[model samples]
Target: MRIALNARILQAPRTGIGHYVAELSQALSCDAQLELDFFHGWGWSRQLPAAALPGYNKWTTLAKQVPGAYSLRRQLDQYRFTRGVSRHAADLYHEPSLWPLEFAGPMVMTLHDLTHVHYPQTQPRDRLAEIDRRVGPAVERARFILADSQFVANEIRQHYGVAAERIKVAPLGYAERFRPREAHALRACLAQFGLQPGGYLLCVGTLEPRKNLAQALRAHALLPEALRRRFPLLIAGMPGWRDANLAPELQKALASGAVRLLGYQPDEALAELLAGARMLLFPSLYEGFGLPVLEAMASGVPVLLTARTSLQEVAGPAGVYLEPGDDQGWCAAIQRLLGDQPEWQARRTVGLQRAQEFSWKRCASITASVYRQALE
Candidate 1:
């Protein structure tokens, strides 16, 4: 079997879909019966350079600033890249994200989430429009679809009218590096950010409306002054598209030294950062799988995630769930998680056990089965 994968997402720092593509590709490459070809670039661009550029998004943002650049790139990918896919002579093309680049072969697309459909307000108008136009056609063309969670699979079925038989739920896998780290081993990395093991709360996600950071700030501020001083909130993410306002209240909390924003921590430091944190604050309004929650659990850290969306499926009984907009509830949960060591330890143990259930090897095996089905 031969497969050509849309590996362009790997050019940027490994976020949700990027992580999926990279990990699955690596795991799939190990399969003796399958030949894997990674298509790292599209349109006029044929491949990514040997070096991994850490700030690839900066260039992408700059390109988007140029009027009509987005449409031109899409056109080139649609027209020119179709030929590239043909040249690979792939038995199947797997797009790890929503949009597939004009492949006529049996294509499988992973629709991670319908956030654009559920919460259109979370994305920019132009981007929403683009998704509306492109995603529908992509769905129509794909022989099969992959969903990160059952929550998203149902969304696709209901909203896009995709047949239930056509969509498969392929849960994400966390890297081995995300497991627990010793305090001394992580001391040097933690010290750079003024973080002490089990001393500070952490939030990891792109700063945007869907992440619900505003409510998190409010909840953090609701903490008693002594608690706030004892454990500050550390945010680690790059700014994503949205008008998720940093309200005056959050600004006040930030100014008072209860919050610190560490934008876009590199992958090398991610394991240490996650392990050192007291708890992962991920009160996302929505998610497909909530990878950070899993990573945190795997790191032996308790997570406070929203009860809504696909979070419950990933977190299971291991997570501490709260309503997305319940600042008071969030504050109380944080206090208990930090102050009560026994409870924290219990959650931590359960989380580690739960995290063990997922692996990229298993993901690859399932994916290969899907490819066979697609080919059939």
Candidate 2:
């Protein structure tokens, strides 16, 4: 079987979908029964592009400012994509993002979340409009749809009326690089950022409204002065849309040295960061699948997360759940976890056990099965 995958998401800095495309593609490539061609916007190749390209963000920011720039770019990309698909002679085309190009072949789409539909306020107007226009048609065209979790599969059925049979729940897997690291091994990397092993709390996600980071900031501020000084909150991700909403609490926390913003740590640095962390905090309002929770679990770090959506599914009984908007609750949970070493170690042990259940090889096997079923 031959497949052409839209790997264009890899052109920008990796968030969830970008990581999905990169990891899944590499795993799928190992299947000897299938041949894969990656379409990187302008052309097709057998190899995936680097995780991110230089100046890609600058180019995208500039493109958004010019009128009709996105439309023109899309048209050109579609033309190139159509031509590439013909030459590759693909049996199927997979779109790992919300927008799928015009492809007539058997289509498999990965709907990571319904964030745009559920929380339209979280998205940019133009981008939301584009997704609104294209997603319904794309869903109708696809022979099979892959969702990151059962929560998302249910959302698809509820919102789009996509049948359960046609939607497959293919959970994401963490890379081998996310495993636990010894303190000695993490010393050099952590030293670069002035971090100490097991000395700080971690919140890993893009800064945006949907991440509910302002509440986290408030909750962290509620910590006792000495506790705050000892274990500061560390946020690791790039600035995303509507991040200004977090400014008030963010500024206050930064002033007191109770929180540090480490914008966009690279993939190479993530394992060490996770390893050295006292715990990972993810209070996302919604998620298709909480990859960071899984990665943190795999790194032998306990996680504190919102008990909703796929976060509960991913974390299972291993996570410490907190209400999204309950700053007081969050503060209490943090205090309890820090003070209780036995409970913390127990959570870490279960987290590691839970992480063992998921792997990219399993995800790829399931995805390959979906492809074969689509062909049938």
Counting clashing residue pairs in each candidate, in order, gives: 0, 0
The local distance difference test score of model 1 is 0.83
lDDT of 2 by residue, 1-376 (tens): 9998999888898888888888998899899999999999868899999768788988778766766566677788899999999998999988998879988778999999999887897665666677898899999889999988999999998999898899999988999899888899999999987878999999999998888878778888889989999999999999988888888889889988889999998897977899899999899988999999999999999999999889988999899998888999999988988999999999999999999988888899999999999999
Quote each prediction's TM-score: 0.94, 0.98
Q: Where is model 1 more than 4 Å wrong at Cα?
A: 42-55
Cα lDDT of all candidates, in order? 0.83, 0.89
lDDT of 1 by residue, 223-313 (tens): 9999898899988888776524765765687789899888878776987899999999998888988999999999999999899889999
User: What is candidate 2's CA lDDT for residue 67?
Assistant: 66
List where candidate 2 sits over 4 angstroms from the true fold.
Answer: none
Worst 10 residues of 2 by lDDT: 63-72
lDDT of 1 at 326: 84
Task: Please report the TM-score between candidate 2 and the true structure.
Answer: 0.98
